[model samples]
Target: MHIDLIRTSSKSLPHQISETLSQRISSGLLQQGVRLPSVRSLATALRVSQVTVSKAYDVLEKRGLIYCRQGKGCFVADPEHTRRQEDGRWQDVYDDYLPRAQLWRNFDYSEVKYPFHIAAIHSELLPLKNIGDSFASLVTQQPELMATYGNFQGDLELRGIMRDHLKTRGIALASSDVMITSGTQQGIDLVARTFVGPGDTVYLEAPSYTGAIDVFAGRGAEMIFVPTDSEGMRVDILTRMCDQRPPKLIYTIPTFQNPSGVTMSIAKRQRLLELARSYRCLIVEDDPFSDLYFHAPPPPTIKSMDSEGHVVYMKSFSKVIAPGCRIACVAAGGNILSRLIAAKSASDLGSPLLTQRAVLPFIAGKYETYAAQLRVTLRGRMEKAAKLLKLYAPPGVKYILPEGGLNLWLELPASPDIGKLHELAEQESISFLPGDVCYSAETPSRHIRLCYSQMNETDMEEGLRLFLRLLGRFLQMGS
Candidate 1:
């Protein structure tokens, strides 16, 4: 029997061999009951030490990819054996995971829960009672809205309310410039479709929001990820990129960004806007987390600062208000906005009229008292989570103290295998996002992100303690 020894780098020999062998066995290239070569012979042939070959076999046995008939040798396990062992593995993973993926994929939101939820970000602080009241009043007062299709530009009154409310944040735009979408995910897709055709390039943060990246990827655009530091997107690198191959659009969160919790400095914002103009690229500024800030007032959005009108700004009410409400709005230049609205007409007819109507009263200060109360409620939860993180995190795990936003990025101890941690965390019924998942091609292995916005202090503490416990166990395993 001929077997190809896949070449592996010196550092990853064991893992590479195991992965290669696993694929071979799974594909039925290695038949059941087939005796594999002795570890000593394979090791000498592959120019690796005996230990490396032994480790590969050990892992394959552990994963049930192969079995050792003691004193005989390693042989391929029965294909049925592996299949039976995984009888419901994919289903379990999907039942547990598909909700989050669907939520990210713009699936129906009627039963959606924010993935990795902690329960505090939702029911505790949202003005659900006020929202429910407005929603009922709208449906009762104008039952025709329910019977008829909503306007393509969304509810006129709600757009007017948004136009007026945005003045406080330094964005002055007419209702015509606003096109309400199902959520920011749709807004991003609209922008991607409007400007970026197949093979076009778009620049964004290295470890940026995955949902946005998925949208661009689906549209077949080439993504160029620029690194970000505490101060935010590396403008110098962006400048060089623009000088080389100017991308079709520049996507960013100038305010408190997700995952990293790093807010872009005002100077970087200015440079970014300047770069967009000089390069003549559209800037998709996603500001979903801007309103969640725990610190001083954020700098005005890049769109607000744009004089040439190269920026199309998107904002979501899901994180700050109520996700189930499913409201997001985009403000762009007159030209871009017009094109986006035309596309919106084709995508879903229009945003839900009642949902838009329900948001108007809340934005118009009709529910100011409760809104203020909710802000205080979220701030308290954030502080409590921070305190617990400071208490329980193991040494070498680093994180930025966020001003706003639901999550914090943790740089962990021991360059532990994140896939293993994900498996371990899954076993314990606790979930977290591995750092590599957030990144675009270049994976940063020494990190993970946790969202405190969904959980209360007690749950945050409990979840973190569980994470630390797993980390300790992983370290003990010498991985």
Candidate 2:
């Protein structure tokens, strides 16, 4: 078989040749078990040196795209054997994981540019020097940590630091009550795995964090979405739902909710905690954005008010600090914390020690000072984004100026089709999370979530302009 090599490009000839052959194998043009041209023959055919052809073959072999045999030419690797499951038999074994897998598959937009779907803090705002210095100190002063596994409950010093941190927020918990997780996502998964199962009911805010929704749904928990107003999840509605059928877990983002960006009122927070206690249901309070408030600090967390062990509070540092560290703490009483710790141990042995060590000093030392400054920067961005939205949003579109958090939820007019709008936005290189994915159940939604914190000031404004232009065009077409 003749293999084409591009020698004109700036890339090394061997690299170009290997990439071409790899593509052929991946595309199935080079069938499994088919022997490729010999190194000498291909070198002569392409008028290149044998060393170059051999180097290309070596590249392909190392990548597992091809395998070399003694006294034989290289052959394409069998795609079936490389796949996780050769046939469909493994489907029965991992049937439970497919729903969440499919959810993630559908949510992927990695290829999109200027994406507003992500809720992460912009990288530019992170304290790079502080994190780098902490990491460097850990490596230089305590190199032994590199070879050892950390405590399954997490580093003792970090837990102590997190305990002190929680006290300032009104949640009193001992160091033992706090368990370290990879992040809020893992904390949610651990709780879901330990407490929920098929046919168990899990209540969540109507438009909640998609990650939480996926985790609970994957565990086969029956999801019941509680509607939200400007004040966050309606505790009254939740109370009625609990009376009808007590849920196993009430998963909520009470402070600066994921898509809605609404903080629960203090009265509602108290009522929700009381309802959870009376119903004997556990509340998984995901509080990632509470520290990001623009005005005065939001109300006391429900976990703070829980004298009974009814609330599992997960506080993520990824929002304010570097996400690369993947450090977060879960605070729950002994009974639940034990189960969560067990689940965490079963998941990954423990989170990386180096990362925990790297983040500990930052959390203990400069975190409060950094967060105070970050809040101001994020508030400014939020205000600027809101002003742009107000000026450029399509006529009749409605949105509430969020008091805090990185996202703004937009409610489109009845005329413009959401699916069409998404398509048009993509054509303009703009992207945002469609509201339907945030819901536990599929339904028509005239809403979208725009995350203002993922992009810089310039990109944020430009993207919003593109998005509004498309939205206006779609509205006009529908009119």
| Number of the predicted model whose lDDT against the real structure is largest | 2
Quantify all predictions' global Cα lDDT against the true fold. 0.71, 0.81
Candidate 2 stretches with Cα past 4 Å from truth are 1-96, 101-107
Candidate 2's residue-wise lDDT over 28-71, tens digit each?
A: 44557666788887788778899998998998888677888789
RMSD to the true structure for each prediction, in A, is 9.0, 15.2
Model 1 stretches astray by more than 4 angstroms: 1-120, 366-371, 442-444
lDDT of 1: 0.71
TM-score top scorer: 2
lDDT of 1 by residue, 1-479 (tens): 22233342222668756755664454344546666778887787668899998998998998776887678878788755332354543432221101012123222222322234221275666778888898899888888878778899888887877777677789988888887888898899888877886557788897778677766655545577898998999999999977777778888977778668788988999899888888788999998877665657777788788888899988887556778877888998778889999889999999887788787778678544664566566677777767766776666668887877777788877677776776677667677766764554433358777777665456666776777777667766764
Residue 303's lDDT in candidate 2: 90
Residue 44, candidate 1: how far off, in angstroms? 37
For every model shown, the clashing-pair count is 3, 0
lDDT measured at residue 402 in model 1 versus the true structure, 0 to 100: 80
TM-scores of all models?
0.76, 0.79
